[model samples]
Target: MSSNRDDIILNVDKLSKRFGGFAAVTGVDLKVRRGSIHALIGPNGAGKTTCFNLLTKFLQPTSGTIVFDGRDITRLPAAEIAQLGLVRSFQISAVFPRLTVLENVRVAIQRRQRGDSFDFWRSERSLHAYDLEAWERLSEVGLSDYAHVPAGELPYGRKRALEIATTLALDPQMLLLDEPMAGMAHEDVGRISALIRSLSAGRTILMVEHNLSVVAELSDRITVLARGQVLAEGSYDEVSKDPRVIDAYIGVGHG
Candidate 1:
C-alpha cells in the first residue's frame, strides 16, 4: 500500500526457473512493500510453487536475483535464507503430529536458537526457557486453549494454526505462505484468514492462494501469473477485471 520505493522489502528481478527443457518461470519481477499482504495468484501450473521455491532458496534459479531486506540472497542456501528471517510455510500442514501444541512451538524456538539441531538432549527445565514465548505465539494465533493438546488431535484448521505458530517462533520479518488455505473446511477459512490479517500488523506476507475471495479480502496487492510469466500485477479490483486474467482462469479452470 505504501508507494515509497524505500519500503520495498523484497525485490525480484528477472527471476526465472527452468526444469530441463521446460521453463516454469520467466523473467518475473516482483516488489513487496513492507507490511503489505501480497498475493500471488494464477491458474493451475502457472509456476506459483516454483516461484516460491526459488525465492526461498529451496531451488536454485536458472537466472536472476532476489534481494530481501536490501541484501542479495539469490544464491543463498535455504538454511541461510531462513536465518536471515525469510521464513516460509508449505502448502501442506507441517507439524509434529505427536507433540503437544505448546511443544511444537517450543521446538521451533529451539531450532531458531540452536542451529538445525533440536534440543532433544536438553533437560525439560532447560527447554522451559522457550515456553513463555511459545505461549505468546500460541496466543497470537488463537491456539492458547489447545496448548496441551496433541497437534494430531486438533482439527485441521487448528493444525494449520499450529504450523503458523511454529513459523512465528522463527520470528520472521517476511513470511511466504504456500496455499495456506489449501485443506481448510469452510469454517476454517475465515478463522485462518483473520489470523493472517492479525499477523500482518508489523510484517510482510507474500502468499500463493487459490481462494480468490480470500485474496480480494486480504491482499494489498495481487500478482497474477500464467504459463510461468507475470500476466498482471495490481490491486484485486484491477487484476480481477483484466481480460487476460479472466481468460487464464477460464482456460485452465483454476485447479
Candidate 2:
C-alpha cells in the first residue's frame, strides 16, 4: 500500500455483495486517486449502485476490504465514514421540501459544525451566524440568488445544485455522487458539468454517472464495471476504444 501511497485515496480489494442466493457484486476492486474525479459507470444492473452503497457504507459488503486514508473501514457505518470526510450526496429526495434553499444549506453546515446538538429553537441569532457560510455555499453552486426560494420550488436541475451545495457545507474531502446529471436538460448539464469541474480543484470525487459525455469531460480517470466486476479502467478515450467495452454497451442497453 505504501508504494502507491502518494496517489490512491480509496482502495477496494475483492469487494463483494450478496443477497440471499444472488450476488450483486463479486470480487470488484477499485483504486481511486487523491484529488481526482473518478467515475464508476456501466449499463443497468451492473452493480454500480450496489458498489456505491458499499463504498458509502450504506450497505455492508459480504467480503473483502475497503481502505480510506490508509485505514481499513470495511466494517464502518455510513455516519462513521461521513465523519472521516467521505460524504455522499443524495438524490433530489434528500432536500427538504419546506425549507428554503438557504435554510437547507444552513442545516447541513449545522450538522457538520454541531453534530446532533443543533437545536431548532436555539435562537434565530445563532442560526443567522451560519447564514454567511450557507450563502457562500449556495453561491458556489450558483444558487445564491435563489436563497429565498423554497428548495422544493426550484427546477429539477437547480435542486441538484442545491443538493451539491448542501454536501459542500460539510466540507467533505471526498464526494460520492450518484448520477449527478440524471434528469437534466442539456443546458443544466453544462452548468453542473462546469460546477463539478470547479469543485474538483481540491476534492476527490467518485461518481456513478450515466452521461458518458459529462463523464468524458469531467473524469480524470474512469472505471467501467460489468457483471459486478471491473471490466475496464482507464481514460475515457482508452476505454471507449476497447472492443469488449463496445460490446458490453451493445449487448446491454446503455444506462
Candidate 3:
C-alpha cells in the first residue's frame, strides 16, 4: 500500500545493529503509519528486541537512519528521544512497589513536567496539581478503582495496566511496547488486549509480540523477520500462509 509522507509517523531505512562482528539486525526498512497498530513478529532470535533498542536509542545503530514525526533521530540519546514523544514500555513490569498506583503515574507526569526533578519532599498541596491528570491516566487504563492501592500489591495483569498508565503520563505521540503480553494469564490476556486497543486511539503503536493470536487480532500490518532479515510483510493472513514463514516457525519454535 502507498502511504503519503505525512501519514507516516516513523520512517526507518537500512537499519542494522552489529555487536562486535556479529550482526543482529541488518538492512531492514520499516514505516509505521500514524494512529495504527503495527506488529513485529518472528521466531526466537529474530532481532526484534535489538531493533526495538535501536529505535528507542538504547543502542546506537551500526548503520541506517531513523526519522520520527519529521526529525532525524538516529543519533539522539534515549532520554532525548523520549522527550521528543517516543516512549517505550519494557517487557518487564516497571512500577514503584511501595508507592500507590496513583503515585506511580504522578511521578511519571512529574518527570515529564519537571525534567527529571522529583519533588516528593514538597508539601501535599504542591503536588495536588498533578493528581487530576494522574487520575485521568489511571482511568484511561481502567485503574482508577485501584488508585489508592500500592502498585506492588496489584495483580500481574493490573500491574501491566499500571505500566501503560505511567507510559501515558508521558504523553507519547508514538508508543513502542516490547512484549506487552509476555507473562499474562489466560483470562487477563483479553483485558490487556482491550486496553492496548483502547490506547491505540489517536496514537501510533509498534509492538514486538510472540503471541500470534494477538498479532493477528490487532495488527493493521505485520512484518516478519528471520535470521536478522525481513522475511515477509503484509496482513496476518498473507504472511501466515507464506511457505518461508511456515518453515521458519516449524524448524524452530515460534517462542
Q: What is the C-alpha RMSD of each candidate to the true structure, in Å?
A: 1.4, 1.8, 1.4
lDDT of 2 by residue, 182-241 (tens): 999999999999999999889999999999999999998999988888899999999999
Query: Which pairs of residues collide in candidate 2?
Result: none
Q: Give the alpha carbon lDDT tens digit for every residue of 97-193 in model 1.
A: 8989999899888888898777488899999999999999999999999999999899999888899889988889999988999989999999999
**Rank order (by TM-score, best first):** 3, 1, 2
How well does candidate 1 score on lDDT at residue 206? 98
TM-score against truth, every candidate: 0.97, 0.96, 0.97
Against the reference, the lDDT scores of all candidates come to: 0.92, 0.90, 0.91
Span of 10 residues, lowest total lDDT, candidate 1: 89-98
lDDT of 2: 0.90
Worst 10 residues of 3 by lDDT: 86-95
Model 2's TM-score against the true structure = 0.96
Candidate 2 residue runs with Cα over 4 Å from true position: 1-3, 91-94
Can you tell me which runs of candidate 3 are displaced by over 4 Å?
A: 91-94
